[model samples]
Target: MKAIVKGALAAGVLLIVGAGIVAGLRGSEPSAGPGGAPSSGPPRQRTLTIAAASDLKFALDELLKEFRAKHPGAQVQVTYGSSGNFLAQISNGAPFDLFLSADAAYPRKLAEQGLLSDDVFSYAVGRLVVWVPKGSPLPVEQRGMDALREPAAKRIAIANPQHAPYGRAAEAAMKSKGVYDAVKDKLVLGENIAQTAQFVQSGSADVGIIALSLALAPAMKDQGRYWEVPLDAYPRMEQGGAILKRAEDPELARQFRDFLLGAEGKALLERHGFFLPGE
Candidate 1:
């Protein structure tokens, strides 16, 4: 019996030693990095998801490219839509890390609902424009808002004023110019500003009231010509951004917010036709 017991103990010791050796070998192997490069340790990967307004589409795309260059290990995903819709989503506990609104009011509303991690800050002042695609029958530059009254202007697109800030501004501008009542019947509502631009670009609408930022985008710049809507015609389109309370990566969210308020971000916004808050 003693001989049998001794043999069993020796076998157990050998198995334990073998397991430890295998574990050590596995641990010594270098880990894979982002692009499958050998890493001395586990690489850090962080991701942030942002919900933004449609007007930010172009400028934000450029900003993200620069941001990712600076934060090589971080990934950012953006969803663009109407600010009011995003506000409703975040209020209901959407898993967004940040929210960039077309109007400060939406972010302020979120903050009031206690859904934001910090106070909202104005990032830019969005401008509205009257856009007509190339080869359109109406003389947009010559007639301006009056072009919508022409028979050739059968369909005019504007973001849904019920939710989109740009839409509200467009309505306000038309009303101020004494054209809203005249063009009301010709208006076709787009779900958002980007879609409003699409409506005109695709010839679904004869013209559109859209964000100047989108008009300045390379895709749209040559596709159409735009006339800036008089700034005084509507309430200021003060845009804002904030970090969400439920952000999985709060630090990253804050960094990105700061980046938007920084020099590079301001420059991009300006190039895309957005005005700084004070400007």
Candidate 2:
């Protein structure tokens, strides 16, 4: 009986030792990670991450959704901000796979700095508008810079020119109209086009100059009306896009870039009041 008990204990110890050896071999063989679990499969095919200017917020998203429908495996995530800021991020290694600027100049600068793919493209032309909220005494089209000049227009809103093309365009228009000097003191700046629209609609500012896309948004429809700023008043808002040179998934970036310039994408941009260069 004592020998039988000793034999059983020996068998149990051997079984435990064999299991440890099996586990160590499996771990050393790369079949398992250091955590002693099965190794993860191949790395995921990364999605394209685009950092676009704020004005392209909605239009770009609508196009992205369309692209995703056609290519279920590929994904696109958009981060929208000022063109200038987005440009800086590209320079500082922001991990943005692509950039779509509110103006072409930034993309051009990126290309000149060798931060962009060889094939940068002009995707769309952005338009600026002078907008006045509905039910307000101010008339948008009839008033123009004159409304901004009115004492009633004490709080006129425009985007910060340092950041937004629409703001620069509005500033140029103000200068062209010879109202910048008079209204500059009254100008309240928004960080971006979307916020500029909000300043007027919410009555935080008496009036605003914002992107046509925002003015055309359903929420803004009842809230405001806008007149397209004359193109000559400012340099063309030539929006451009490119895949970043440092992108880990450059082909995915290229696919998104092509998709944005394609027929469906162009139509989406047009539907939202963005004009093409050829248009």
| lDDT, residue 29, candidate 1 | 37
Each prediction's TM-score against the native? 0.85, 0.82
Cα TM-score of candidate 2: 0.82
Model 1 TM-score, 2 decimals = 0.85
Please tell me which predicted candidate would have the highest TM-score against the true structure.
1
Model 2 Cα lDDT, one tens digit per residue, 1-279: 000001112221110100000001111122555788866754344466778777776676567666666666565566666788788878888888788888888888888888876667898888878888677777768867667877788888888788778788888988987888888888877766666766677777788888888777666766667777787887788888888888877876777777788888888889998999787
CA displacement after TM-score superposition, residue 104 of candidate 1 (Å) = 0.5
CA shift of 74, model 2, Å? 2.7
* Whole-model lDDT, model 1: 0.81
- Which residue runs of candidate 1 sit more than 4 Å off their true CA positions? 1-42
For candidate 1, write residues 44-123 as lDDT tens digits.
Answer: 55778888898888788778878877776676778888788888888888888998999999989888888888989999
Estimate every model's Cα lDDT from 0 to 1: 0.81, 0.72
In candidate 1, how many clashes are counted?
A: 0
